[model samples]
Target: MMGRTIFIDPGRCIGCQACVSACRECDSHRGKSMIHLDYPDEGRSVASLPTVCMHCEDPVAPCAEVCPADAILVTPDGVVQQADTTRCIGCANCVNACPFGVPKIDLQAKLQMKCNLCYDRTAYGLAPMCATVCPTGALFYGTVEELRAERPGVQVADSFTFGTTTVSTGVAMVVPADKVQWPVPGGLPVVEINGKDVR
Candidate 1:
């Protein structure tokens, strides 16, 4: 459904970058990927987090609020469109304003690039490329209610406080259980990779 929201379950991510690759297939972004795969801490563990535009629901998104040229637009469905090429001045205000760090300024094109949630596909009742190709079900395509029903232990939060203002987003983040205890020592268990033990 066009109204369906995206859910990200960081626990299920495997650092494969399939979502990142699929994002590049969107026609709107062409060869550039709007999704970013991040390793919050490499030394602690190998877990990864795939981040897309949170599609903030603030009446005036931080990016749009900071854009001097008014190039960024938030649609009725809460999808944040890429900055208009004609109006965008390659200024990094949008990039700096985003709390999730989703927006990027294209130096060559002089425009801001960010995930539009595969509008072309979602508008047609199709899944976004990233959600479609995610093997771990980390990048989910469903409603907030559905995600909550299926994952009772995880809390879904759409609003976050950045400094003084609170920003609401269309996308929901699946928060892991508080004070989660891992069975393995130091979070990651020593495992054998090939013929040697990896610790």
Candidate 2:
């Protein structure tokens, strides 16, 4: 899976929760789903976005950097893995440091968990479970060229600017063909839906 990566298209998501369910089936985090469905406007609308680890690249993964116990690990392919249960101190440093807000601290288990892109399967040349079950193609796994050929009207983006800090990631986001970066106002993370940007 050298060049393959997960592509998220929020506009196409149907909020079916298929990805979340499938994620839990992975061997790494059995019985617990690392993927989260975020409803930007909970009461008003059903518009939901699937949130997964971006696997930060520019600063080399803030989650891994702030891990005092060195529980977090990054693969050579740039997939930021979930924390090591044996080493994790349950300090929530990675959870707070992640700009995408993907990590979850299991208080009872006292462990940090997040998506590893299903490394157990991906390493064997298989698509991630979440991407495999996504009905709306909101979460897809493939190379950039494959995505471009499959959906020519959209473009892929991997870099995002949060406040003044710009971060690149292993996963790519499928955005409108005309734009690459959607500026975040006041440093708050924003998500694009129906061609409009929203927080």
Displacement of the residue 108 alpha carbon in candidate 1, Å: 2.0
Judge candidate 2 at residue 29 and give its lDDT: 91
**Candidate 1, residue 34: CA error in Å?**
0.9
Angstrom error at residue 14, model 1: 0.7
Angstrom error at residue 62, model 2: 0.3
Q: Give the TM-score of candidate 2.
A: 0.89
**Root-mean-square deviation of candidate 1:** 8.0
Model 2 CA lDDT for position 148: 78
lDDT of 2: 0.86
Best candidate, lDDT-wise? 2
Residue range 1-199, candidate 1, lDDT tens digits = 1259788888899999899888999999888999989897787899898988888776457888899999998788777888988899998899997878899887887888899889899878788999999998898888766666776656666666654556677886666565323211112233655459776
Off by over 4 Å in 1: 148-154, 177-199
User: Per-residue alpha-carbon lDDT of model 2 for 1-199, expressed as tens digits?
Assistant: 2389899898999899999899999999999999999897888888898988888888899999999999998888888899998999899999998988899998888999999999999999899999999998999899988887888867778887886777778888877766765632223454666659885
- Worst ten in a row by lDDT for model 2: 181-190
